[model samples]
Target: MSGPALPPDVIEIRGIRGFGRHGVFEHERADGQEFVVDVRLELDTRPAAASDDLADTVNYGVVAEQVHQAIESDPVDLIETLAQRIADLCLADRRVTATAVTIHKPSAPITVPFDDVVLTVQRRAGEST
Candidate 1:
């Protein structure tokens, strides 16, 4: 008789926050700014779960490093661009089924100081064109 198939598994990473210089304003972009980023990654890991192999599933450390790199790598004109780029990067991995990205800017340049501004985006691997 054939052995039963392995059950599907999911690998998740959360609460990865960092400070970076990203904004539209000249000073904000020039001098740099602070940003908090949170990300969630969903993927299938039946192989890894059964085989106990790192290569069979997504790596949380790698994902976190990638998100961090994406945020600090290039100057973005808008947070929207930054968020979208992040989601796209996570989705690039065939193993990742979906990804959620949340970015918070607490020190946004404004006439009045505010608590914070948060932007969240969710994208599925196939749903996005």
Candidate 2:
């Protein structure tokens, strides 16, 4: 017989905005920029649903705060690094089997007119990449 079925549910947190001083250019870091983050967490919600308890599932409020903190503090030179940090934070919760983190810089330091620069990183429970 097969083991118990896992829930194929995803929790999406979108448009998390924060001020971050991250970039290659010195001025970019000095001036700082607005960063928006979106994350999709893959987890089994069956336990939470059955118990109807917040503890049985990942607390997204805490996750949002953690992601915002990652963006606002410990400025990095690359959005890749920042995205990885956010992924790591989300993966910290054992309930989350995988996570997709998207970082958007609307005010990128580009001479030409551009809408936005975005970087996304995906991480699984065990693998770093």
Clashes of each: 1, 0
lDDT of 1 at 106: 80
lDDT string, candidate 2, 2-78, tens digits: 99986569999999999999999998889998999999999999899999999999999999999999999999999
- TM-score computed on alpha carbons, candidate 2: 0.93
State the local distance difference test value for candidate 2: 0.93
Model 1 lDDT per residue over 1-129, tens place? 989965435555665666577887888877876777887778776778799999987877888898888878787888888899899988888988788888888888877868998899988889854
For all candidates in order, the CA lDDT equals 0.80, 0.93
- Residue 119, model 1: lDDT of 92
TM-score, per-candidate, Cα-based: 0.82, 0.93
- What global local distance difference test value does model 1 have? 0.80
Q: Against the true structure, whose TM-score is highest?
A: 2
